[model samples]
Target: MAFSGGFGVTAAQGATNPNNDFQVANPPNDGISSLSWSPTANFLVSTSWDCEVYCYDVQANGQAVPKASIKHDKPALCSAWMHDGSAVFSGGCDNMVKKWDLATNTPTQIAAHDLPIRHLAWIPEVGLLVTGSWDKTLKYWDARQPTPTLQVQLPERCYALSCTHPLLVVGCAERHLQIFNLSNPQTPYRSIQSPLKYQTRCVATFPDKSGYLIGSIEGRVAVNHVEDSLASKNFTFKCHREQADIYAVNSISFHPRHGTFVTTGSDGVFNFWDKDSKQRLKQMQKCNAPIPCGAFNRDGSIFAYAVSYDWSKGGQDPMASAQGGNNIFLHATEETEVKPRPPANRVGGRR
Candidate 1:
C-alpha cells in the first residue's frame, strides 16, 4: 500500500465517469499493448506505446490510480510478473528487457534482443524466461546466468507468445506456429503453418494446458491441440469483426477455472467464448473504440480489458493519440453483462 498512499484520486485520469458494470482505470497516454495481473495481489500492471508502464490497485470497489509508473526510452511492447509478484519484466521497442523490482522501485537491464522484443513468457517451475523478438529468435534466460542458456532461430519474426508451465507456444510472422517444451529448448515439439493466413495478434493457452488459442488481425481465431489425438478437435472461427470491415483480434485470455475465454478486438467489442462448446457466451457493451488487450485475475473472478486505439494502424481510422483511446475497464466474472442467458422457452410463459 506504500505506492497507493498519495495518488488515490477518485476519478482524475482519463474518463472520470464510472458505472456498476465496468470501472475504467487511469489509462496511459498512448495505446496499451499488454496487461498482466500480479499472481499474489489484487494489482494490475500494463505496458503502453507511450514508452511507460502503469500499476494499479484493483481491490473490491476500489478506484484505480497510477500507483507506480516507469518510463522507458521507447514504447514498452510487453510485460510479465514474476511468480512471487516481487518484480516485473518488461520488453520494449528499445530492444531491451528490464526487470523492475517492486520493493525498491528500480529497473535492471536483464537481456537485450537484436530487434524490438514483442513478447515474453516466464516459467515459474523452471525459473526460465523466454523472450521472442522481431529478429526471429527466441532467447532463453536464467536470471542467475549472465548469458542466454539457449537460442532458437525462427523462419520469421515473433508476433505472439503463450506459456502453460513447461510448454511455450510462439506465433510468428509468415503464418508459422511453433511449440517448445521449456525442458528441452533445442527443438520444437510441433512446428507447422498457422491455420489462419493473417498475422497473429495474440495467443493464450487453456487452463488445463492441453492446447492453445491463437488470434489473428483478420478477426479469426484457431484452436491448436498439443496432442495428436486431440488434433481432430481443433478448429477455427471468425470473430470480433463487422460486415465488410476487418479488425484485429488484439487480445485473448482464458478464465482460470472454467472452459470459457475472452477475446478483445479493434472492433470495439469484448467477446466471451466457451471454447469447448464453440459458442459465444456473451458480448459486453462496446467500448466505441478499438480494444488492445484483456486479462483475467489469477482466480478468474475478475476480468480487465483496455479499450484504446490499436497502435497497429490496421483499421481504416486514423491513429489514436493521447487525446483519446485510453480507457481501461474491470468487470466481475459473474457480471450480468457477461452471464449466459436462460433458455427462451424457460422464461416467463407468454403463450
Candidate 2:
C-alpha cells in the first residue's frame, strides 16, 4: 500500500488515533434536521430544514462528503431506502411522501399526507411502508399503489415508530410509545406502551440470531429475547453527555457486531454505547439542532444522521449567523482559515 499521508497522532507504541472525526461540509447555516444511511452501500442521506436532501459517500476512514443531492420544494423530515437499494423514500413538512428511483434519478409523483410526516420505516418482511405524521395517524402503504393500505389513528402527536416481526412500535409527541401486533395484516392490535415527551428523539427494533432490542429518545437502550413480549417497559440506561444538555433524543442504531449502539441527541452529540453493560464507548460530536433521526451503516462500521434546523424559538425567527447556511457537513476537511486542504479527491476516488 502507498503512504497516503498522516494527520492523526499515535496513542501508544503502535496504536494509532486515526482521524475519524466530523467536519461540517455544506454546512447550511440553517443546520441539518435529519440523516439516514443506505442499507447496503457506502452512501448517506441527510435533510436540511432549508428544503434540501443530500447524499454523500463515506470515505475509507468514515469521513463523509456530498456525492449527489436533491433540493426539494419542502424540508424533508424522514428518509429511508428500500431493502434492495433501488429507491429512496422521504416524508416531510410539506405533508407529502415520495419515492426516488435511483436508476431513473427521478422521483415519483409526491404522495400527499394529511399532515407533516414525522417518521417513516420500510416494513422488513413485506412490501409495505409506514409513516407517522402530525395528522395523528400512522399510514401504511404499498409501493405499487398510490393510496395507503391502512391508516391507524392516534390520540396525540405522533413522532416516530419501528417494526419487528409481527409488530409495529410507535411514539407520539405527547410521550406515547405504542406497540401494535401485526400478526393479522388487516388488523393491528396494541401490544405494549411506553411514555415520552417531544423529547423522545427516535425509536427502533433490532434483530439477531434469536434476540431483539428497543431504544427510546430518553437515551434508554433495552434488549430482550426475540419473541419476548415481556420487554414492554425494560429500558434502563442513559447516553454519555460531555458538555451538552440532552433535551431530545432523535435516533438509535444498534451495531451489527459487538452489540454496540449509537444515538443522536438534542444535546448535540452522536453517542456510542456498549450493548449489554450499557456503557459509553465513544462520541461523534455533530448534532446541533435537535436531531430528528440517525442510523448506522449496514455493517455498523459507519453511520449517518439527519437533523432539522433549530426552530425552537419559532418558525419565523432569523437563522443563526454561524449556522445560517443551508449545507450539510459530512466530514471535516482542511477547507478552513486554519489550514484548509485545497479540494483534492472527490467521488470517493471512484470517478
Candidate 3:
C-alpha cells in the first residue's frame, strides 16, 4: 500500500503491544457504531457517534494511516463501501444516507429514512444499496437515482442485517427475523422469530453462503441454516459471559477464507468460533472497554476492532472517558486463530 504523508504513533497506540495486536494511530473521538473494510483493498471506514466517518489505509506492516474524514449532521451510525472501493455510503441519526467519493472527498445525499438508519449493506450481485432503518422499512437505492427503487415495510424496526449474494437476513425489533432471497427481492422469502430470547445485536452470513449467524444482547449466538430440511443443524451457543455476569454480543464477523468467525462483545473481549465443529477456537484478553464492532480485512489476514462504549447500560457510561478514550486495534491473525480445527480434533468427530 502506498501513502503520501508521514504518520505519527502515540503512546496509547503502543499500550496493546505491537507484536500481536496494536492500536491504530487516530480513531474517532466518541463511540464507534460500525466498521466496514473495502472489498478490494486494505482501506477501512468507520462510522462513529461523534458525527464523523473516518477512513484509514491499513499498511502491509499493520500500520493504519488516516486517509480522510466526512461529517454528518448527527451521529453516523453505519457505513458500507462501494463494490469497487471508489466510494463509501454512510447513514446516521440525521436520517440521511450520504455517499462519499473518496477520489474527490465530496459527499452526496442519496437516500433518507423517517427514523434513524441503523444498518447499511452494498449488494454487489444485485447492484443495490440496502438500508435498514428504525422506521420499520428497508429501502434499496440505485445510487444514480433520487428515490429508492424498492421499499419494503418490515414487520418491526430493523436491528441488524447481513447479505451474502442470494441471501439477506434481517433481525428486527420484537425478535423478528426476515430472510430475503435476493433473487426475488420484492417480498419476504421466510419470516420467523429469532432463536435467542433477547434483542438481536448483530448478524453475519457464512462465507460459504449456506447459512448465517445471529448474535443477541444475551451473549448467545445462533447458527442457522437456510433450508428447512437442514433444521436439525441449527443450534445456539453461549459466549462473552463470566460467572454471574453476561455481556452483549455486539458484533459478528466471518473470516473470508476459513469460514470460521469472531464475535466481539460488551465484555471488552473477543473470541473465535467454528460453527461446524461447535467449538470455541480462541479468546483474547479483555480490553479496557467494550468492543462495539469489528471486521476482517479482504483476505481475513488482519482483524480490526473498536474498544469503546457500546451503550449497553442504555446511556453513556463514564468508563470510556476514564480509560483513555475510544481506540481501534488491529490484530495480525494466525492460521490457528481462525482456521477450523481438524475433523479428528472436533467433538463427536462427525465432520
TM-score of every candidate: 0.88, 0.74, 0.93
Tens-digit lDDT track of model 1 for 191-299: 9888888888888877688889989988888887899899887888888767788888898988776657889888778888776655677766665577788898887
Model 3 Cα lDDT, one tens digit per residue, 1-351: 533123334444332432236568889999999889999999989999999999999886668889999999999999999999999999999999999999999999999999999998999888999999999999999999999999999999999999998899999999999999998888999999998899999999877777889999988899899889998988888888888799999999999999999999998898988888788888888877788999988888778899888899777576745556788877778788899985433421122
Return the lDDT, model 1, position 148. Answer: 91
Clashing pairs in 1: none
Root-mean-square deviation (CA) per prediction: 5.5, 10.2, 3.5
What residue runs in model 1 are displaced by over 4 Å at the alpha carbon? 1-22, 314-316, 319-323, 335-351
lDDT of 2 by residue, 16-48 (tens): 111333443554434566667677786777766
Compared with the true structure, all predictions reach lDDT values of 0.79, 0.57, 0.87
* Ranking 1 against 3 by TM-score, winner: 3
- Model 3 alpha-carbon drift over 4 Å, by segment: 1-20, 316-318, 343-351
> How high is the lDDT of residue 188 in model 2?
42
